[model samples]
Target: MMRFHISYLACAAAIIGAALTAAPTAAAHQTTHQTRHQTTRLVFPGQSIQRAVDAAQPGDTVLVTPGTYRESVTVSTPGLTLRGTGRETVIEPGTTKAADSCAEHGNGICVLGTKDRDVEGVTVASLTVRNFTGTGVFAMATDGLTVRNVTAVNNGVWGIAQERSVRGLFVKNTARDNGDAGLFLANTIKEEAGAADTQGTVVEHNRLEGNRIGITVRRLRNLTVAENHLTGNCAGVFVVGDENKPRAGALTVRDNTVADNNKSCPATARLEALQGSGIVLTGTEDTLVTGNHVTGNAGTSSLSGGIVLFKSFVGTPGERNRITDNTLEGNAPADLVDTDTGHDNTFTGNACTASRPAGLC
Candidate 1:
């Protein structure tokens, strides 16, 4: 009886082993119906960028060879990476300008995102965009977008702009001679939606020069602008509240070389009135401008200084804005300018050559 029981247990074990061995084969057969992923599409000069974009799928890369292509490309596909061979690959807007490109601004490269369609996880790298009618690279309503190693020169209004986009990264790019801010970020969502605070936009290790403003951040939360060389612009960095919402803050400007921003602005109707300053904080709260080397940003206006803090009627006062640990030297008029309305704004541990509100250093 013991031998019979042992034989029956051995048979049951053999059956279980057979089933386990066949399960993987069955799974592989079922997965055979899935489509194969598309490979990288190599595009030559004079090829249509839009065609390659249309044919690309998620996880596919469209790589353009080194040359000049006169085309305005629109990328609405998610998870697509459009990379050029190098800075020699220039993309110019084509002859027939689309009146409706880039939200009617007519951009060189537009990454579109909306309620129905979401264009997230897109990357534009290693290209030069010049002479576009609108922004060089415009990304709206996107998430996880990256723009790196690109040269945006002489674009219409902005060099690189992100509106209502979250988790964006703009690094190692050069934005020069743009009409407006070299790098811009703002929110398009209404404040009532409670999603106005788009977080984690990083602008680092870039050169912003010869623009209206070096860098501009508005209606954004948790922004980090660090280690950038902002020179020869109207303003080094401009952080302020938007006209409609007027309650934007939580910015960090540190470790930047803000110098020689003595550009002239003659009461322009459109340009930033506060020019020739290293860093300007208007209507902000809970901000930090620290560890920056600010010098030679001199102009005749009071707004031209090492750092200026003021309050606009657009939002709350400039409360709790700390300006500390910065190296301020030889700025015109004063090293620092503080208005009375900037309540609770402190300047401690600063090495300034001179200060407007004297003896604050």
Candidate 2:
């Protein structure tokens, strides 16, 4: 396995133009009016966030005040808005242990949708979620789910994870110091449980740092990851397919800044073996990687590059994946690496300082 030590000196000059502050807290909504079908529930620090969640009816708003609340919150109700009124509103693992099901799933705040009761149209915003055993925010099998303007830090696994959900939005969030991918979106297509693939999922304007992967998309469709700052991680962005499912298509990774992602973490052999790269596409199809600043993600091996297109045993072959219109520079070993199994993947109109598998530039 290739071990990595995190460093940002190489990309110091590169990151000058990037945003350096936390996501704007003032953008948080003060109060939202209840709809005809919904009501609003208010809670304070002493009252558990989950208490309001349980008491909430469909389309209800659960607004929390500014304070630290140590608890594991799960949302099973649909059309609910669980929002923090202030930036200081925090949710940490209070009595929840790693042995619990919520902690095992790495979900500090989980939105689980069942066949009888799907948690659709749920919004969670303007909160800090940290020190949880699992993902800071986890949503599954929901439609029209929105998570915005939140900070997720120092979690055990993925910072924000969404699976088997459609039409979801994740914006203006900061995710750092996580064990796995900072933002992970995966759709599990299982016959027994009626799990379906996700579509129209948007991730934008987020800062992802110091994680195994800045952002990860697996087996998703019609997804967009744009305008995000990805730095100081093991790998910047990874888009791959699950071996058991059909490959993901219609994906876009655009207009993002990815730099200096070189951190060490424990992983499966295949993941651990991969070199540091700004973006990696394994067994994906019909994907676009464009208009991004990819720089200074250089590892010791030839595998480290600005962008990588490769075939893996875990999924389908990478075909028709376009790598275009990007500024790629200062990557070690080579700027671009494409393995033999990658077929019909094009690299055109890319402005790069260096490249491998020659002639792609």
Candidate 3:
């Protein structure tokens, strides 16, 4: 009986030792899996920026050091932040030695955030994005994106293009001398056809200069554009909505200094057609253009005005707009033109340097 009890005790001790040994292996497997799923940070020293972005997981930060990275990048992941150590971190398109006939297709930074998952905390800050074959920063179908303290210049297309159902903040950025509009916001087919609204985009406190147009908006709702310095461009702000789809909505343009926008030289007459006026509102409703200093926007061939309003194609008169308390001067032709297509649009207390007939005012 003593021998049998000792044998039983030894077997039990062996079983306990096996359990103890297996516990650490099970725990290690779990820890390894969790580490794989955790947010990762990638540092780019001499490596390519695209490679770093490709290796980054969701919720990762790609901290780029000061260097000129000549490559176009596309980020499709959600919750990623791509930031530079300073404004000196430059990213541009790779130049090709091929003939100019070859069509180039790439942007400095392109974010295609289209999943049902929210693409939150995608911050791009303190970088210089330039000379891209496409837009400098293209935010398409994204939400909760932020761009700050960046400079976009000399792009083949728009400096910053926000399309589809993009809701985000664009602040303290400079866009200059791009081939297309400095900043453009448009609704894609998905947003326009779907029931969801592109309602929460804010463009503020930026400097736009020497572009075809400073800012252009189409088929957007509940947008605010204020306190921006738009100068030496073709036009300051162009707000037009799709009359066919009938999606024009509320926009507030106030407290901005729009001046000297049509500054393209006569030698660039072909390019001057793209220049913008102080403010051009077409086929839009429920807009307020007030408290702005609009001046010195002389179009290349035609007379430019501080504000030009046109009727909707659906024969609905442009209504419910308030043009008040704006200092309008130095633009060609007149400070404001109603075109007789709009009705019930009031202009009160607006200081206009160009005199008009009593009824026109």
Candidate that scores best on lDDT: 1
Candidate 1 lDDT tens digits, 101-192: 55357688898888665578999998999898679998888888999999999997899998888888999999999988899887752343
Error (Å) of candidate 2 at residue 184 is: 0.4
Compared with the true structure, the alpha-carbon lDDT of candidate 2 equals: 0.77
Clash totals in order: 0, 2, 5
Candidate 3 or 2, higher TM-score: 2
Residue lDDT tens for model 2, 139-161: 88788999998899999888999
lDDT of candidate 3 over 225-343, digit per residue (tens): 88999999878897766454455657888889999887653334322254436887766778898899998776634325777775643444566778888888887667776753665
lDDT, model 2, position 170: 96
Off by over 4 Å in 2: 1-38, 96-106, 115-117, 189-197, 242-245, 266-270, 273-275, 301-303
Query: Could you give the candidate ranking by lDDT, starting with the highest?
Result: 1, 2, 3
> What would the TM-score be for candidate 1 when compared with the true structure?
0.84
Candidate 2, residue 87: how far the Cα is off, in Å: 3.2
Itemize residue pairs with steric clashes in candidate 2.
Answer: 106-134, 106-135
Model 3 stretches with alpha carbons more than 4 Å out: 1-42, 95-104, 115-118, 189-196, 264-276, 300-303, 312-317, 355-361
